[model samples]
Target: MLDWLITNSWLVWLVLFLLLAIIEMMTLDLLFIMMSSGALVALFTALLGWPFWLQVVVFCVVALMMVLFVRPVALRHLRRGPREQATNVERLIGEQALALETVTDHSGMVKIGGDTWTARSSDGTAIPAGARVAVERIEGATAVVYPAAGPGPFPAQ
Candidate 1:
């Protein structure tokens, strides 16, 4: 069986390529897609009557190029997603919390969603406890807030 497979390496390479592509569909992480491309390149080389060693070399070169160059560019785009300005979902945007403790000169604790978080006022004003505040931004784990005045952070809904 082994000897026969070595003789018909193109079939083996083709099956391997197809298996990789199929698995890639399930995984969706993009790593196997690169391997699948190399496998297909190997299959093509084998179909062209190239010896096993040359086919292996071509597969390795193609796989390396795909991994090093193509994958990074693809992943970078995938990681960032469409660059539509900062929204409320990101940290400290569109959040309402109460000042847990007195905020004096830009330092205090604010309670939001049943959790206490370090907070600061952008205008550097001292806020008392039990004050309704609006999250303006976040630095690290801390949330910057301003007193809720006039219309609240969220409009009537």
Candidate 2:
């Protein structure tokens, strides 16, 4: 059994490659993919009749080099993009809102993005209803707003 396994070492390397590839899919990180590339090198070495220990050494070297060199480049390219992609509460910043009720420095209500939210004035003042405001930031469940520069109320149809 041992003799037959020694002769069929390529099968072991191929299986290792497949397992690493499956783990890469699950992890979505580049680490496993780099290791799988090493496993592929090991598989080729096995096919070329290299000894098992030498194949493992080659695998280790290749995987280490890829992780130390290639992975950083790949990650940099993958993450490179526009720095601004407003999401969730971040999208509300600088957005216009309508004061639904008298908003004071401490407590009030405003309609932001068509949804009502507790609000406070950024400059600690009172804002009357139907006034246009700009969301400065969100504090807990409240939106901090400032008077928007421009027309106050929308024109009636």
Candidate 3:
């Protein structure tokens, strides 16, 4: 088995590629997957009858190239994704709500999409109950809202 392995070193590269690819799946960090690409190149080099030392050099260079160059581009593309990929909390921005109680800059409550939330007035003014509001942003567990145009910006509490 050892003699056969010494002669067929491509198998070693193939195994290394598989192991690294598996690690990439677990980590999702893009590093291990870059090394796996190097292992794939080394496997091809070995298949073409290259010396082991040359195959090692090829693997190292290719892996270094991927890590230094391709990884950043891949990360940027991943981050760019789609605009609609905003999270649920992010989607809450600009959504309409109703002031369940008087909403002041200090404390209040509002209902957004049928869900109750701790609320604050973005402009530090009191918004009366039953007033329509729009979410400006979420700070911690609180939603900051502004009086939205249309009905009942009533002065309640």
Top of the candidates by TM-score? 1
lDDT of 1 by residue, 67-118 (tens): 8999999998887755365454463466777887987656899887667789
* Candidate 3 segments whose C-alpha is farther than 4 A from its true place: 1-9, 25-30, 48-54, 64-94, 101-104, 122-131, 146-157
* Residues 89-124, model 3: lDDT tens digits: 787888888899999999999998868999999999
Off by over 4 Å in 1: 83-137, 140-157
Clashing pairs in 3: none
Task: Report the Cα RMSD per candidate.
Answer: 6.1, 6.3, 5.8
* lDDT agreement with native, every candidate: 0.82, 0.88, 0.92
Model 2 pairs whose backbones collide = none
Q: What local lDDT score does residue 25 receive in model 3, on the 0 to 100 scale?
A: 100
**lDDT per residue (tens digit) for residues 1-157 in model 2:** 8777778989988998999999999999999999999999999999999998899999999999999999999999887645376567877888788888989999889887668899999999999998888999998899999999997543222
lDDT of prediction 3: 0.92
Alpha-carbon TM-score of each model against the true structure: 0.58, 0.53, 0.57
Q: Supply candidate 3's per-residue lDDT for 60.
A: 100
